[model samples]
Target: MTSATRIATLVAALGAAVALGGAAHAAQGEGVSEVSVSGHLPTQVTVPLAGKDRTVVRHEVRLAAGFVCRNAVTNRDLEFSDLNWCSQRSRVRAMRRYDGMVARGMLTAEAPVIVLSAR
Candidate 1:
């Protein structure tokens, strides 16, 4: 994907993360162990390239609630990572998923790391 497209995607993902994080915070004491997020992950993604666009069908990724690492400074920076979500474990799972997303290019390599604690 082009740099612009990557940045845009990163920004949107972070926006969702922030909103969800707030909700998670509010609902922390409700004994909610798991969360599900859908619609964001698509089977096919249209990526813009040089004067043209291409479509890529990503493999099925199970949805689960996990921690998201976003740029601590700002969302304008295309540097962040997130775990799509899954079974509730703890910080260990969140950290693992965070690294996994970064490896998958779902999050930027240089994005500042801020892992929201599991509630």
Candidate 2:
């Protein structure tokens, strides 16, 4: 075979390999849907009044935030391997809830905020 023909064949093989590699990579990701922030429902808490035995029921407030990966076909949540996948917006929302809980006297300001995925 001529040198020019050999080079051409090699180039074609490389191109085909790259295309197949990309297709395989895409196929591997086919099961995963777009990433999204997980939803959390608020819970009511009963707290005793300071210096008194009386307790009161506080309003509902969210206590955590999380990231969720779902299946593209079924829309069901799938396990994620890393906490880094959680978005900044989700973290900020959790902080807001924590602050609200403190402001409403449901929690103390020194309480730690919870991350659902981290737990």
Q: Could you say which candidate leads in lDDT?
A: 2
Residue-level lDDT tens digits of model 1 in 1-119: 99999999999999999999999898986886777764332222122122211111111111212212222112322233322221233334544654576467655444333233322
What is candidate 2's lDDT per residue for 1-119, written digit by digit as tens?
A: 99999999999999999999999999999898899885533221222223321122111111223322122112323234433343333445545655575578765444333332322
The lDDT values for all models are: 0.39, 0.44
- Each candidate's number of clashing pairs is 5, 0
RMSD of each: 25.6, 14.8
Regions of model 1 farther than 4 Å from truth:
29-119
Off by over 4 Å in 2: 33-119
The candidate maximizing TM-score is: 2
Sum up the clashes in candidate 2. Answer: 0
